[model samples]
Target: MHTGDLAVMRKDAYIEIVGRIKDVIIRGGENIYPREIEEFLYAHPKIAEVQVVGVPHERYREKVLAGVIPRDQADPLTLEELRAFCEGRLAHYEIPSRLRILASFPMTVSGRVRKIELREEPARER
Candidate 1:
């Protein structure tokens, strides 16, 4: 299962794709998938969209960082708010250690958020 593509086999011998793998965060030797965290964040009323990324870390090799776009641009969500929302629902390692709540995400002509670029760019202060 390269990239952790989740699929379910049908009785008739077909497979269905449920979810595709997003970037993986390795913290203290554990591998955490971003999509799971992203899905959990989506349930929050304030979070309009979110993308989780792995940022460079000296001790753990990588840490979880979330690029979030709030439902209301004027009112932004904070790192604590998001962490509190994700508490208990998500594993400690799965929780975003860094939060970048932006008004809008950088996108491509195809309308897809550029995750690779996001991993490299510096985030604006809250």
Candidate 2:
């Protein structure tokens, strides 16, 4: 697929989709896998779900922004809190510099989170 997908072929000739290739954030030339960061944060008690996206940055061209849904609505982690949590566990580049405490992710009828719509949120709000 030309839509930036990572896939694998099995011995039985089945094509299995892995992850979205375009979701990779190139920050200061470091490859930051959003899924890895998302999974890492899932282990934290405060985080219920997270979606990492790349936003424009003058220095790195792109930086990480995490859309977090808290386990407890009243206890959403601050950007600094999340940074502290990821400090030694994840590489510095993989840590999110910004956060959006979302009520819920925009989803398609097919049940997939619509990252395309998520990406356009800033523009839409203007």
Best candidate according to TM-score? 2
lDDT of 2 at 68: 91
lDDT of each: 0.81, 0.83
lDDT of 2 by residue, 6-124 (tens): 77798999987656887878899997777778888999889998888877787897788898999999877899899999999998888898888988999999998887766677435
- Model 2 lDDT vs. the true structure? 0.83
Error of 1 at 52 (Å): 0.8
TM-score of 2: 0.81
Query: Pairs clashing in candidate 1?
Result: none
Which pairs in model 2 have colliding backbones? none
- Give candidate 1 regions above 4 Å deviation: 1-22, 122-126
Alpha carbon lDDT of residue 73, candidate 2?
Answer: 94
Positional deviation of residue 43's Cα in model 1 after best superposition, in angstroms: 0.8
